[model samples]
Target: MSSFLIICKSIHLGNTLKIANEMAKILECKVLEPEKVEAEDIEEAEVIGLGSGIYYGRHHTSIFKLLDKYSFKGKRVFVFYTSAFRKVKFLNGCEDKLLNKLRKHGAEIIGVFQCRGESRLLGGVCKGRPDERDLARAREFAEKLKKKFS
Candidate 1:
């Protein structure tokens, strides 16, 4: 069986962790916070999922640090993110930023998923998000990834 690793940075409300957990459950993989992940963890993973909540239009710094600390060359990678806005334009390039970094490491990009998340800034938008619908979508995405990479 192929091994999967999901590393996520959920600094605030945990929306990113919620989505990561859903994917992990469907993929039957392990989910770890960025701080808990090590070089060996990345080395052992066949397929890696990187996730985070959009913060100031980018993934949390911790996620970037994790990427910087390890090399993902030749690994298959997928990315998922939770953000405050539903409009893709409002995402502030979070997906692209992560994707580019992964690409720079020569990782094969397999899939990307993004969904609205409740925001604490300026009141809240998409309240109660990473809701059932979002989670279901995340799980479905995971299933497709599994099939494609299996």
Candidate 2:
């Protein structure tokens, strides 16, 4: 079986981590914080998922830093995130930022996953999100990716 690794930075309500955990369970892989990941861990994985909670309309700065610090050249990479808003237009723009970063690092983009997350900003929005329904979808996404790539 192809090995899978997820590098994620989940803060706040741990919303992104919940989604990451679901995906990891389906992939039967380990989830590591960006800070905890080593170069060898990245080197050993056949598939790597870069995940984080959206902040200020983009991925966490630590995630961006990981992209800057490592070489993902020719690596199979997937992107995932949790955001308060799920609008197509807004999401496309948000994903574009991370996509551009991955391209610059030479990662071979494989898939993308995203979902709504509860946020306390602006009198709280999307509360109780990334709920069971979101987790089920995340698992299904991982299963499909595993089938296609593994």
Q: TM-score: which candidate is best?
A: 2
Give the candidate number with the greatest lDDT.
2
Q: After superposition, how far is residue 4 of candidate 2 from its true place, in Å?
A: 0.5
lDDT of 2 by residue, 62-107 (tens): 9889988888888889999999887477444567888888998888
lDDT per residue for candidate 1 within 1-150, as digits (tens), equals 678999998877899899999899988899998899988999999999998888878888888898788898999999889988764655476788888988998999999899999887869788899799999999899999887776
Model 2: pairs clashing at backbone N, Cα or C within 3 Å: none
TM for every model, in the order presented, reads 0.94, 0.95
Backbone clash count for every predicted candidate, in the order shown: 0, 0
